[model samples]
Structures are given as structure tokens and as C-alpha cells.
Target: MESAARNISFKEKANKALGIVPEDAIISKSYLFVSFIALLVGGVLGLLQGLNRAGLLELPLWFNYYQVLTAHGILLILVFTAFFTIGYFYAVLSHTLDGLLPKVRKMAWIGFGLKIFGFVLAVIPIIMNEASVMFTFYPPLAAHPVFYIGLVFIVVGVWMCAFGSFIQVANWRKRNKGEHVPILSYFATGVFVLLFFGSVPVAIEVFMIIPWALGWVETINVMLSRTLFWAFGHTLVNIWYLTAISAWYVVVPKVIGGRRFSDTLTRLVIIMLVVLNIPGGFHHQIVDPGITESVKFLHVFMSLAIGFPSLMTAYAMFSVFEKTAKKKGGKGVFAWFKKLPWGDVRFLAPMIAMIAFIPGGAGGIAQSTNQLNQVAHNTMWVVGHFHLTLGTTAVLTFFGISYWLVPFISKRVLTPAINKLGVIQTIFWTVGMIFMAGAMHWVGLLGSPRRTSYTTYSDHATALGWDPYLFFLAIGGTLLMIGIIIQVYAVIHLMFFAPKGETEFPIAEVEENATKTPYWTERWGVIIVIMLLVIAMGYVIPLVEMIVNAPPGSPPYSPW
Candidate 1:
């Protein structure tokens, strides 16, 4: 009892010293502020696209559908996710591992500036209609040279932050010799490691595209660029997944008054994710021509391999929920579910996110399969899959995190009113995604194409048949926009206007009886090397084959 008291006292002191360090808080706040602003802009643009797709709104010439589409994709997918992940994890680093190092903080600020500037530069071309290549920025559809240059800067900025995270983690290890990294910081480490390494292929792709975009090069290797992009593209998707799951594994347990499921299992999941992630990108290209059958199968296997960790995560989370509920004197399997805090926005939003992933992940696996992909690739089904996985599964969880995170950093508390508003926001987002994504999936199966403006193909029967589903898609987008408004408002209020008080940076403790995690999990160097080997195994042969037998390069075509 004395020892326990002493430990508690030390923690109190440590938290007092570390509580919402002004400088560290500012870094995360700035990132989050930008994140929400991007969401606002992108959400509006999404509404425009949805309306256009439904044939409800014909956009002006200056702001056409493709331009809106491109901007919407980049803002939400690239800007919002990137900034929020960095911001949230930086806070994770600060809270879990004491305050951020001064140098690390400086690096983060510099990275922030670079990313913002880069985004501005990229946006300019899109506004001028000089770049509407969409987020994938696929090579035969090149944008202005300046756009690619801007992406280079963004990539560099992300690298700066990634390295800063590395420095912070390393510094902590040096000071605390034989300790495991705090669970949240360990998650940050995995995310940043991915940010740095995953961006490499995209960086190379952009460099190759710049000269081609500038007309200095006559032609670009379309297939090669695509292969490289997906290498980064799918990994970027997983980066967001890893971030959301961090909250699930660490924050959710604490919010519900339970210990984390298992430290070793958790750590192992991170390791498995890092090692197996990059090659899974190939599954995105399974339907693309030029890849050999054997290589395609390899990628399919790798992609499915990535899902295994998610299943493990699912099992762990369910176990935690059941155990916690039973501890609350709830009896029976189904009845315990009723005991959870459904009214708490922090839990409600993320719990819904977890539930949404069931169908989202199922769709993803279906898309990964060769035959199924042939039907869905480049269709509205693909669009629905993206939104379901990223928009609802990842973005909703981010929303949940913001409820407490913004307050925690801003030295405020999440008020009851805002929490209730958040629950409403969660409902709006959930219903919106189902309407939009479900319609997209159904219409896509009915043979409606994506990446095009609404038209009846001169009033053709099949095209006219898609109208009802597209209208539902519009309704979903409208609801989602409403959700975005409430969410952004909640964030703003939590950041600046809520009653001044301390909000806990919730990181759950490991269960008392859990087995010790192997120290080998700490060998990030070995893990990264293995990640590299897996990536090379998945890429080298197929990449070599693509390069050696490549078709003649294609000149840039700005269809917009």
C-alpha cells in the first residue's frame, strides 16, 4: 500500500509538471486547427460533387466537378489526415513520454510550415484548372510541374516530422535505458516510421513526374509511376488505420474503465503491421495490366495478410469490452453491451467507427480479390469503399479523439452540451456514410462509372437507372456536411471556449496479470530491416519485369 501510494504520488507530480505544456500544446493545436479547416473546405467541396453527381447542381465553369473532386480528395485525404495524425501523435508523444524535446518541437513547427506552404502551392494549380489529376495523381494524367514540386515539399515536411518523432523516441530510450516505450508513443513511432519510409516511393514517383509535367521530358512511364504511387498510396491508407487503432487500443480502454487488452499482443500487432504493410499496396493494382499472374497472387496474399492483424485487434477490443462490462456487474453476453457508456461522445463515436469497419473492411477484402476487383476497380464501388474505410472508420474515430484531445491540449474540458452534440454528429456521419457508400456500392454494381460528372448518356436507359442511387448519395453528402459542421464547431469550442479544467490524456494501463512483452519488440531497427525485405520481396521482380518490358512512355494528357 505504501509503495502504491508512492507510485501514485510520483505520477501526480509528473503529470503536474507535464500537464498541457504550453509549447507542446500549441504544436498540436496548430495542426488540429488546420486539420479541421481542411475538413470544412473539403466537406463543402464534397457536397458540391455530391450535388453534381445527383444532377442537382451544375457547377460554374471556373469551379468544375473535376477540380472540386481533386481539391476535395487532396484536402481531406492528404491534408486533413496527415495533419491530424501528426498532431494527435505529437500529443501522444508529449503526454505519454513527458514533454516534447525542444528540438523535436522546433522540427514539428518547421514541418508544419512546410506542409502548409506546400498545400498552398498545390492548391493554386487546382484552382486555375491546371491540375485536376485527382489525389492519385496518376502519371499519364500529369498535373502542372509546380503541383508535383509542391508535393515534394509536402513529402519533405512529413520527413522532417517523421525524423523529429524518431529523435524524440530515441531520446526517451536513452534516458530510460531498459524501459518499454509508452503504448501511445510506441504507436507514434510506428506511424512516423511509416510516414518516412512509405513516402519514399511516392517521392521518387513525383521526382520522375516533375520533368515530365514541365514538358522537359517528352514522355512518362505510366505503369512505373502507378506502381510506385500505390506503394505509397496503400501504405498511406494504413497509416490512418494505425492512428485510429491507436485510439481504440489505448484511449478506448481507459475511457471505459478497463486495462488495455495485452501489451505484448498490442506490440506484436504494431510490428506485424509495419512489416507487412508496404507490399499490400500491390493489391491496389491487381486489376491493372502488365503485372504477371504469379505476382498478382503474391500481392493478393500479402494484402489478405495485412487483414490478419486487424482481426487480432478486433478480438482484443471485444475481449476488453466484455471484460470491462462484466466488471461493472453486468451479467450475460448481450446484457453487458448495454452497460457501456453509449452517451459519451468519446466512446460512442469510436465505437460506431469500429462497427462501421465491419462492412468497410469486408468491402476492402472483396476489392483485393482479382475477380471481384475487375468488377469494381475504377467504379463507384471503389469510391464507396474508400469513404467507408477512411471517411467513416478513420475520420469518425478522429472525431472521437478530438472531443477530449483538443480540450486536453487547450486546458479546457469537454462540456456535456458538446458531448451531446458530438453524439448527434456521430449519428449524422454514420447515417450519411451508409446512404452515400451504400448507394455507391449498389449503383457501381449496376455498372455506373466513377470519376465522371452526372449525365444520362444523352438520356440512355442504363444511365437514367443510376439517378435514384446518386440522389441518395447526394442526401448522404448533405448529412455528412452537417456532421462536419457540428464536429468542427465542437472542436473549436473544446479548444477555446469550454470551462477551463484539466482533461485527462487517456492512456490505459496494461492489465496487472498480463505477461511481459518481449524486449525484441523494442528492436525497431530489426523490424524496419524486415519491413524493407518484405517490400523488396513484393516489388523487385514485378517492378523489374514492368520496367524491362515496358510499353512506350505516354505524354502528359490534361483531360480537364
Candidate 2:
């Protein structure tokens, strides 16, 4: 290994130190391609949805509204976000730790294969309208057995890759005693760790639902199943937020020419996130029956606790930007903001996403509040909130990441045209989200239901009054779809068509040296125990109630 390392070229040597190689890069790129493809499919579906919801278009017999909506939700959130995050984590693990072993490479391939197979299973059922249960799959409105099975495969397959990468990091820990793991890897580990535990309920949900869907069971308890599903659902989106924040922590400082605030502080925030995000899912089920008030209140408390880290992140992000701008001779409060690299698509795209999170995060807290949640639950306001956070914040960051990652992995120079296109895409997306999501928020407060076609809503006076806002939603969706197309084009041009060259992968920012991270933060035992206790406090009673007072299980009924 030593001899081989010495024989490599300068760039290869740098890559070696980072623990990545051309082959590993290829593995990461493949994951990214899946993300891009999903973005394309999901984005188009979103446009169709917007049009349908505005009463501007009718669904043909072949393609009904619900199927397209189901497909859109699954593709964008499940396929695009999950695949993209895994791929990005692979890169982070390789670069921040030791480059992956050949064994780990094989593990990745196996994981990839499983996911692809699962995706095929999932999509075929959705396309056939046998799985038009929507993304929630709220059983009683049962999909084909294949839909549940496909979901299990996806969950497990992604879990496999997450587990594999974590093992590699663990091995690295064994070899390097008394050293702090790199921040990016630590962040990646936190994400997957949350996923590992958060996914249990989903795995159980799928396992149970599949048998029921297949008619192997007489019925399934609907409320119990919803509790189980939501146990994983909101946490899943939190994983996306953590991943995006990790990206910002690792890359934004470099982009703005600053240093990471403090390693100890950052680790603490991540630890807080992992522990608090788990029980946070309960807030989503506040309106659902079979859960007690005290337990629901506990869930609300946990949700508020999770918000602290987001607040911490916000402080750190703006501080880094401020310091960077000041270093370039800025004065006065907020004056530094103008000096940021706004012209750089790589920086601008995510910065805007982060900016959107300020509002998105607030809405999250509001929705989690048992009092205010009465207003937001199951409304278009909920839709608007997620659009701001996951859609704009997370999805936009993913697009920004692709701007540099494509070139970095493809061994190509990103042409100026591609960069310009990316900036244009971001603009289109930001404007689109404002019009679309803003309208959703307004109409939701006025009592508009989410997830139904506009034509159906036309029977009511309030629904008829929503026409102007619906137009805004349709227009916004159109712009956002165009943005997705432009982004896909930019990546394709960079990867396969752009001239071969070199671009530096953005590594974490640190000032020369650090003393050390807190020992408690590094130890899994401390965080794990606290997490478990908090989770128990929020969950045990409510779940027990669900099992005991649960109504008779509902037999699966096929809508198709």
C-alpha cells in the first residue's frame, strides 16, 4: 500500500490522503445520477399536480391525479433525497476518513443493486395505479402488496449502505485512538445513526402492511399503523436537514472564506439533533386519535428541543458569513452580508436555501405546538411549511451540491455556461417557491384542504375563492419544473460532455490547529442513553395506549 501510494500522481496523492479514488468517485456519481433522474420525474409530476390543482387541466383516464401525486412524493422524497444523501455520505466517509476498502466497494454495489430492484418494484405498482395510496400509504386505503414490499427493500437497501459506511468509520476509530473524527464524517454518521433507529418503525410498518395487503391477514389496525408510520416519517425529513447542515458546515466556510466556529460546539449541536429528532415525530400525530394529551405534550416538548440545534446552526452560519465578509473589510451590522460570494452559483444556491430555513424552521415549531397545530394540521399550510424546509432548503441544497460535485467526481472543469445556468435555475426556483408556497400558506389559513384535486374543491364557495391563489401555485410549479430541467442539463453537461480536467473538492474549514473535541461528545454511550430516555418519555405511554385501546383492525380495501 505504501509503495502504491508513492507511485500515484499529485492529484491522486491528495485523493489518497482523503481516502478516495477514481473508482470510489464513480460509486458516488452513480448515486447522484439516481437523484437527478428522480428529480426529473418528480419535478414533472409536480407541474402536472399544480396544473390539476388549479383546475387548469384534467387528469386523463390513463393518468389519474392520485397516482401522479403518489409517484411525485415517492420519487422526490424517497428516491431523490435518500439516494442523494447516501451518495453524498459515501463521498464524505471516503474523503473524511480513510478511502473505502475494496470490500466496502462491493458492499456499496450490493446496496445499489437492492435499491434499484426495489425502486422498480415500487414504481411499476404506482404507474399501474395499484399503489396510488399516496406517499403516506395510510393503510385501509391499501396498495398492492408489491408497494409495501418495495418500500421495505428501499429502506433496508439504503440502511445497508448506511451501515456499511458506518462500519468503515468504526474501523477507522479503532485504528486512530484519541483523535477526533472529521466533522463531515461525524455529521454523516449522526444522520445514518438517526436513520438506523428511526427506520425501525417503518420496517415494522412495511412488514405488517405487506402481509395485510397480500390478504394474508384479516385486517390491520389503522391507528396503530399510522403511529408506526409517523414514528419514522418526520424523522426522515430531519435526516435531510442534518445532511444539508453538514454540507453547510463543511463547505460554506470555505466558500465564504471563513473558518468553522468551534468543533466542540458543532459536535454538541449534532448530538442534540440526533437525540431530539427521534421523538420529534410525535408532534405530527398530535391530531390523530388513540394518543393521550400528556404524551402528545411530551412530543411537543421534544420537538421544541430539536429546534435548539437549528437555532445554533443559524447562528453559526451567519457568523461564519459575517467573519468572512469582515475579513474583506466590511463594517456595520449586516453590512458583511453583501460581501458574500453571491455571484458564485455554488455558494448562492445553498445560501438562499438556508435563508428560507429561517421561516421554515419557525413554521415547524408552530406546527409542533399543540395549540397552533390545530390551525396547521392536514392543511395546505403543512404543505407550504415542508415546501420551504425540505423542498426549498434541502432539495435546493442538493442541487447546489451537484454544481461542484458533478465536476469533482467526473474529473472535469465546470464550464462558465453551466455555472450561469445553475444561477438561473436557483433564481427560477426561489421565485417559483415564493409564489407557489406563499399561496399555499395563505389559502391554508383560510381553510383549504391539501392533497385533493381543485376540480373536486369547486363544489364549495371557499374552494371557488381559491382560484387566484391556485393560479399562482400553477405558475410557481411551472417555474420550479423548468429549474429542475436546467439543473439536470448542467450536471449532464459537466459529467459526460465537459472537458476533462481537475476541480478541488471542498474540504472542511479549520484554523491551523485545535485542542480537541469533548470526550463526552465523541462517546456514543452518553448520547445514546439520553436519546433512549427521552424517546421513552415521549413514546412508551402513547404507544402502549395505541396497542391497548386500539379499535378493531380495518380490513384492507383496495381503492383501485
For model 1, the stretches where C-alpha displacement exceeds 4 angstroms are 1-9, 16-18
What TM-score fits each model? 0.98, 0.95
Pairs with backbone N, CA or C atoms under 3 Å apart (clashes), candidate 1: none
In the range 1-560, model 1's lDDT, one tens digit per residue, is 49755965697677865587899999999999999999999999999999999999999999999999999999999999999999999998887777899999999999999998899999999999999999999889988888988999899999999999999999999987988898889999999999999999999999999988888999988999999999999999999999999999999999999989899999999999999999888988887889989889878889999999999999999999999999998789689999899999999999999999999999999998889999998889999998999999999999999999999999888889999999999999999999999999999988899999888999999999999999999999999999999999999989888999888888788888778888999999999999999999999998898899989999999987
Name the lDDT value of residue 145 in candidate 1.
84
Alpha carbon lDDT of each predicted model = 0.93, 0.84
Model 2 lDDT tens row, 196-217: 8888888988888888888888
The CA lDDT at 136 in model 1 is 94
